[model samples]
Target chain A: EDQVTQSPEALRLQEGESSSLNCSYTVSGLRGLFWYRQDPGKGPEFLFTLYSAGEEKEKERLKATLTKKESFLHITAPKPEDSATYLCAVLRISEGGSNYKLTFGKGTLLTVNP
Target chain B: GAGVSQSPSNKVTEKGKDVELRCDPISGHTALYWYRQSLGQGLEFLIYFQGNSAPDKSGLPSDRFSAERTGGSVSTLTIQRTQQEDSAVYLCASTSGPSYNEQFFGPGTRLTVL
Candidate 1:
């Protein structure tokens, strides 16, 4: 069975603090891994997609790195505005062929206190 | 260009009542998806539609849930005989194609069942 798990269900960081959120996955095949930021009462906003191990993508203060079994979202000197639930999802295939559906992990709720 | 959009940002209904949620994909996106998010859970994939091909309804939880995409642009998800457990945020997203992992999400519709 394909599954995604995120650790530290909730994390509180002071402004300018740096931390990392983890997303581990067990799937048949690794197609792609995605990261999203979701604010209160709003849908998730796309962040980055990591397709292969050793691949990394960065945007402003956020950087995402991927491995064979898990992905890490590293926040460098995060601010209050960066406080949001970070979701990790993976795209993999089943016997039916390409599984376009995303198997999402319970998101990591992040709070950056100013 | 406008991103994916969902109608009725909020919907309140009784448990036994039926409801329909709509999604309009981006102008040129070829893949549209529907998902459900509960209070403390991750996004649950509901369905996927790609161009003129048959929708992947494998993720749908039950037979009471159904969806349709017309003209390969707008999609609607209908929940019959809704239950209190059905109260959730319905999110819609779209991507260029199956191989594209980057998906654009809309501000979800918050469904409240009384």
Candidate 2:
């Protein structure tokens, strides 16, 4: 069974603090790994897509890195406005073919206190 | 340009009732997806439609959940005989194409079943 597990279900940090969120997966064949930020009462917003091992993507204060079995989202100097649930998902190839459906993790709820 | 959009930001209905949620993807996006997010749970894929091809409904939890993409644009997800367990946020997303593309999501519709 394909599973995506995100660690640290909830994290509270002071403004300007940096931390990393982990998303480990066990899948048949990984096609891509995705990161998203979701605010309360809103749908998730796309962040980055890592297609292969050693790939890293960045925007603003967020950086995402991927490996063979897991992915990490590193936040640098996060602010209060950056507080949101960080989600990780994976697309894997199944017996039928490359499945476009995403298997998501139980996102990490990050709270940045000012 | 506008991103994906969903109607009835919130819906409250009694158990055994039926409800329909709607989604309008971005212009020119050929792939549309529907997912459900339960409280404290990961997002679960429900269905996918790409171009004029038949929708992939493998992830749908039960027969009561059905979705349709009309004219390769607007999509609707219908839940029949809703139950208490059916209460969740129904999210819609879209991509230009299927392969490893970042999916843009809409502000989800919060469904409450009493």
Candidate 3:
């Protein structure tokens, strides 16, 4: 069965602190990995998509790197406003040829205290 | 252009009542998706619609849940005989295509069942 797991269900950091969140996956075929940031009372916001191992993508203070079996989201000098739940989803391409659905992991709740 | 948008940002209903949530995909996006998010859980894929092809409804939790996309642009998710357990945030997202893995999400509709 395809499954995605995220670590450290909750993390607290001081303003300006840097940290990394982990997302591990076990799937039939890895099509793509996605990262999203969700704020309270709102839906998730797209962050990055990693398609292959050794791939990396960045936006502002966030950087995402992918490996064969897992991915990491690194936050650099995060501020209080940057606090949000980070979600990771895996796109598993099934043998049936239709692989558009995303399997998401429990997100990492991040709180940046000023 | 504006991103995906969902209507009825908040819905409060009694158990056994039915509700419909709507989603308008981003202009030109070919893939639209529906998901459910409980308080602290990750987004749960509900359905996917791509162009004129048959939708992938494997992610839907039960038969009581149904959705439809008209003109390949706007989608609606209907939950019948809602239960207290059905209370959750319904999120909608859109992407250019399957290869475009990046999905833009809209402000979710929070459903409260009494």
Which candidate number maximizes DockQ? 2
What lDDT is reached at residue A45 by model 3? 85
Model 2, A12-112: lDDT tens digits are 99999999999999987788999999999888999999999999999999999999999999999999999999999999765677456589999999999
Candidate 1 — which pairs collide? none
Q: What ranking emerges by lDDT with the best candidate at the front?
A: 2, 1, 3
Give the poorly placed runs of model 3, Cα more than 4 Å off.
none
True contacts kept of each: 0.63, 0.90, 0.76
The sequence of per-residue lDDT tens digits that candidate 3 reaches over residues B2-87 is 98899899999999998999999999999999999997788888898989989888889989999999998999999999999999
Chain B TM-score of candidate number 1: 0.96
Maximum-lDDT candidate: 2
lDDT of 2 at B89: 97
RMSD of each: 1.1, 1.0, 1.3
Against the native complex, each candidate's DockQ, computed on alpha carbons, is 0.69, 0.82, 0.71
Candidate 1, B16-45: lDDT as tens digits = 899999999899899999999998898998
Q: Residue A58: error of model 3 in Å?
A: 2.0
**How far does residue B108 in candidate 1 sit from its true spot (Å)?**
0.8
Preferred candidate (DockQ higher): 1 or 3: 3
List pairs with backbone clashes in candidate 2. none
Q: Estimate TM-scores for all models.
A: 0.97, 0.97, 0.95
- Model 3 per-residue lDDT tens digits across residues A74-93: 99999999999999999876
